[model samples]
Target chain A: MNHLASQLVLVPVILPLLGAGLCLAFGRSARAQRIISIVTLSIVVVAAGALLWRADQFGPQAVNVGGWPAELGISLVADRLSALLLVVSTVVTLSVLLYSFGQGIVEFGRDTPLSVFHPTFLVLSAGVSAAFLSADLFNLFVGFEILLAASYVLITLGGTEARVRAGTIYVIVSLISSVLFLISIAAVYAATGTVNLAALPERIAALPEPLQLVLQLMLLLTFSIKAAVFPLSAWLPDSYPTAPAPVTAVFAGLLTKVGIYAIIRVQTTVFPDQPLRTLLLCAAILTMVVGILGAVAQSDIKRLLSFTLVSHIGYMLFGIALATEAGYAGAIFYVVHHITVQTALFLVAGLIEYRTGTTQLDRLGGLARAAPVLAVLFFVPAMNLAGIPPFSGFLGKLALIQAGTESGDWLAYSGVGAGLAVSLLTLYAVAKAWNRAFWQPRDEHVDDDVPSTGALHPGQNTVTEDKVLRLPRGMALPTLALVAFSVALTVAAGPLIGVSQRAADELVERTPYIDAVLGDVP
Target chain B: MSVDLALIIAIGVLVACGTTLVLERSLTRILVGFVLLGNGVNLFFIVASGPPGAAPIVGASDERMADPLPQAMALTAIVITLGVTAFGLALAYRTWQLEGHDDVQDDVEDALVIRRAERDDTSASFDEVDESLPEEEGADLPAVDDEVTRENDEDHESPDDGDPR
Candidate 1:
């Protein structure tokens, strides 16, 4: 039993999913369900941290399930990069659960919605871990499906008219992306004999350049949709706002980054010599421009934040497009920092909605006056998101711009400018939302009751608790924990940058990955 | 392409059906369209993968081993599509029950006041509505346009009483 210590790596991916099933089975008691979920997630979080430390020691270990050879069966590989995403995802999800404890599950599933929320959330945490750890293409696909299936339930849980409609769009877009991804996998398989990502570069190299480009392009299409890049991003802004606040925060924090992660993985590991560099730069520019344009027009806080989510993806992609060492490091740093800052800001938005009964600027007011503690919570993340200095977002944006400028390519240079412009635009949009919801005076009488506009929607009930939802200690502490970590990321940007560089260098170099899989065995 | 022609044509028909359904006024039809679209894409995948070069079975003869990977990828994709389709159908049904119609145009009736926009014929109506509506108090501040969009407001106050409220 002690000999199988390495196999424990799979537990973080398995336990919470099993926990989800247990919650569903024991659905009668909310207290029991909540306890089961929290305890299970806490254990998973510990496992993830241990796994990160283990990966650090082992330097990208691969574990084959059922003791099959790596080439023949699924392999759960944990490198430093995967460990980073795994740790970040588990921490964010567990925190969201704590946040929802007091806020209450107000989003989907009417008959025992909390019962559904816990189980599905646990399953989602498991899915994210699996996707992060997977070294086999087939296992990656399974992980992607797990995450997608869980998300569908969360997205439509409330069954509100707004939620349902938004969910419809989300499902359709996701389905198409899934199909495209499948087609690409099929094409890659027909061209190459195997599906192990470990063996890809050698196999992909033997193939013609055109075929390589095709496979790379297919992957780009699939991941771009997930990342919500440019033309592929229409679904996110509308869909995200309609879900419950905590669910929205998790989705914003983690889901799109999975796409960015895939792009990084595929580009660096699978097809290093491909012609995607220019195309990526073009997409980055358009994604920033179009996403910011949408944000500029929004008066609703959630909607504006969703657009900013799309725009920031452009910054991440810009780092990828550069295809240089510094560039990849910058992209990885951006991913971690963005995940923390984005989720905290969203939590702040959720807090405002709880207090004011609406997130629209016109209806919401005096929140700075109404909930000063919550106001500061919202303020820190908002500035961070806008890439203000001394915060993690600023450090990431600076690294990315520096990488782009070092390349000195005209299109890449303009992409840097466009990224900065988009940041300014994001700042303006978020600031406008802040001024309206927090700074401006609100309609006190209307807010006293249900804040009914009765024009644009069938009211989806937001849990308006009378106890003054000022972060409710447990929730606020976790949110602030993530926010403080974001500050730490900025403070220790040098070491963080070093870690990303190590991961990026190994990936672009590709020799270690191939040798690890194909065996320098015999 | 020596792929199954029938399957290819069926995929095409489904694509057309889906495109049309998604364009319709009712959300139910649109969900049906999405289902058709997803199935169509799956069919297209089958065509692209060279009709499953062999069984998904792994066995003795190396040359005859059908590539199990694409089939595996397809299987996962199909499962995801099924979950999404089910969720979408559930949402449409729930919306229909709540609002009494699945018309996406009227998806939000009372809540999302900020995003509602009236695309009324021309500026003739825009001018009339803007002129007739009183300015919000605090005119000196920046106009962030949190006003309820006129289209949704008009839909709520439909002229005909027979329409579903």
Candidate 2:
């Protein structure tokens, strides 16, 4: 059973890669590619669930490739944090994949081959899984590179002028961060003699205080850029809104969160003593205030959501800065909640764009009357994102605010105040969007090019003489599924929070992870 | 650990030049800068591996052997840099094809903000109530002229003729 659990650690990372290979091989047949991706991801979801259960039941599970010792070769570890995030992220990825298929069939005819999309998407999934499971710093860097390479392809998939422009900024920023990360790794190895996560704590602790702070700051700087923390976040709203909706959805949901995950891992395990608490707290407050201000100023729904995405990251940063078990637990729970809600909101925005051919808020109106279903879909997640009671967002924020106030530091108290104000501001922003895009009467100046509403099934050809564009059932169902999943997170908050608390405890203790990786060596 | 002064100087020069090049608006220059920066970092990995010594393979050396790990890491970094360079060049080519040059343009929204501030206007999207008012009333009411003037000014300045959807 132990061996089996250990082997399961590799499945999430490997299966998507194999699926990507098959997807590329079967590129000419869209159906085959779709089937391969769906089946592979389904298996990954199940495997991740099993891994989570095993991790919760036992402890961290580790697998050393080629039977190499932990220090000598790559090791993949699935502790409670990793496995839980794996399950959530894979589920989100699968839903977005399905949503994109709906979009593809609608935009291009059903028979058109999406050869590049499927393969690149699967590779992206593989990279994300690899990053989550990797147990060493170098392996983590490789994981980031893999995902980033895939993202560059995905972001610029269409090669449109706007896409190419946005992709340039995204690519350049990411490359700079990667270079910085590589330099950090080289510096770390120069100082520590090892890059393995389990071995790093001891070595890093032995370094002089100034040296340790420098290394910590360097890593934090690299990750802050990736995570879209405040001063470094201007590129995100500018770039993310230009991608195709599904790409934007997944990137908004998962990519920055991966950076946050890395921050959690390194801060907790690699540097157990928190030295930069005040710095992180300031960043958290600034990110929240500045991000929401940007969100409130946006006229485009996609751009507004992107800014809000940046804002909500502050909440997670707030939790992490607290540096307590409760704080980590809240952050983990918030990560799960935010991923689902944010992705669902973006998917709904896609639907809005699909129906109206635009996301500009001023030109959009009466969606509640014209497409009541979309209104409901947008409403639920928007309210959830705003921390409305009875939703997962509120619960996650409650957990974070509770953790923050419990810390008793003035900075934390100020963070709690900023968090509360941001929640209200988020509510205002989304409410303004809701009123502009849905509740208000249809504007007479809205584009005449918008197609008349007609609901259509997946396989039907949407092209017609009158140019009626229908809401594809394929797209709506997957989005609905995601919204339902967010609600499920709220309904099942008790068990989920328990799991997160356990994960947070293990993260803070740090021994279970170190032992799982290197305990059996001698 | 013995460090090579020459290698350190080379790394410093490469990184400094790379940083300057990266700050340029031209995509081609930025790509070149990226490559130099990447190579500089890769050399740092080599320096981190310690003083030069024998090959780290069985039966290849009797003396102190060089660490193989940083070399492997450098190789991986080189491969990644190679991939990124290809992609960057392709992007630059695409930008040139599209716009007749590969220099990155200013963000459209930033330009819009500067335009708004020059006319002493707030965000166009913020005041929906003013927008909802009847056009004649918006024009006739002296109190609402500022809003109306701002809206008209935006319409004239906007490339899409007041609709950039």
Candidate 3:
């Protein structure tokens, strides 16, 4: 049983890969693909949960593929940190997958040529899992590549002019980042003859200061681009808003967080004593300020949510920059919180888009009266994102702020201030969206976007457009499930925070991870 | 480990050319730039593999055998780059098919959105000081609504006709 538990880490990555292949084999059978994808993802969620339990109980576990030595062969590790992320991310992906299935039914009926969506999406899940579990730099890069390739397909699903345009920019930016990451890997291997992350700290520490700085800065720059940190983040808002709603939802929620996860992994593992601490802190401040400011100025809900996504990345970076156990704990907890909240918000945005034929704030009005359920859905996540008390977002932010103040550094202190401002601005932005889109009185002019009253579904109370807005059970159920999952995170914060703090401690110590992999190598 | 000056210089030249080409507005140029960049990085990876020597196979003389790991890594990088370039060019071809231009066009609304954000920010700052601004300063407000309505109009015209391909 212990042996099996140790090997559970591979299931999360492998299950998805197998599911993707099987989904592809199902070919054009959207029903079959949906069943295969959902079942596979559900099993993956279970697998990830088991791994999280095992890691939390058994300490960090390592498995070298094909019985090869750890340093020589690829390794998959299930530490507390990776395990926690794997669980949350898979859960989110499952919800989004279900949402997309709902979308498929609505858009193309039973047989959508976009059958390609299922296989590509499963592959993306595999990639994300691979990234989280990978214990080496090269493997991590491979993980990123796999997910990115899948994302390229997902983002350009319909190949519309706008999607193609956005996809072009996204692909170019991703390719550039990939190249930079390759260069960084080569340099690291050149400096220290191995890319095994566990073996890196000693070798990297032995390198001269200037050389170490170069490698660190290079990796940081690559990840900063991937993570959309401040100045490097301009490409995000433009690119993400154009994808189909479910695609946009998942991309907005999980993709950037993967970059954030990488940052935490590299910073905690390879460069535990951060050399660019001050720089990271400054970037956090600017990212928060700039992202929220952009969010506030946006009139489109999708674009507004994108900016908020960028802004909230600052909080995670805050915990990372502090480089303390408390900070890491806060960061981990915040990551789990943000993933759920962000995914739920985007799902709600997708709902809004489906119902209204647009997500523009001006065209949508009195939705609170019309679709009370959606209003509650949007209101929950929006307020949660705004850090309203009793919500997980608030708890997460409070943890980060506590850690920031405990750091006693001026940079961290300033980051706390910026974080507070970002929270307030996020609230104002969401409130403005809510007021305009949901609370404002319906206007006949704005009703132009809807179909003529004749097309209204029977019993749809369309006072102005004379049309009823039907919320699909398929879509709404998954979204409501996610919203409940987030609320559960808040309800279970005490235990979750404990788990996060323990995970943070293990990450901070680093000894358990190294020992688990290298086995007390001198 | 003696440095390979020639390889280093070639890599530098490749990177320079790639950078310049990538900066151009033409999608084909950008594609070429990306290809060059990939090649340059691959070459750098080879350089990072260190001085050339005997094959890394067992039973070969172990005297300064060439490191095979970086070579393996570079090969993977090359495969990935090939995949990316193929996808990018396909996109470029598709763009040409649709819009009849290989040149990337700036999103028409991009500038307008940015300008509005800036205008709103300035007006917001003014309001912070004045605390009582007339409706004239609300000009940016309506402009944003106009953009939304225009976007809504476009969205309504072909509600289901995305990606005719």
**Which model scores highest in lDDT?**
2
DockQ of each: 0.17, 0.27, 0.22
- iRMS per model in Å: 7.1, 5.9, 6.7
Positional deviation of residue A267's Cα in model 1 after best superposition, in angstroms:
0.8
- Quote the lDDT for A522 in model 3: 16
Clashing pairs in 3: A460-A468, A462-A467
| Candidate 1 deviant stretches above 4 angstroms | A1-4, A105-112, A443-471, A520-522, B1-80, B106-165
Question: Alpha-carbon error at B88 in model 3, in Å?
Answer: 1.0
List per-prediction Cα lDDT, in the order shown: 0.76, 0.88, 0.85
What lDDT does candidate 2 reach at residue A163?
79
Q: How does residue A506 of candidate 1 score in lDDT? A: 69
What's the TM for model 2?
0.91
What is the alpha-carbon lDDT of model 2 when measured against the actual structure? Answer: 0.88
Ordered by DockQ, highest first, the candidates read 2, 3, 1
Per-prediction fnat: 0.31, 0.47, 0.40
Candidate 3 iRMSD, 1 decimal: 6.7
lDDT of 3: 0.85
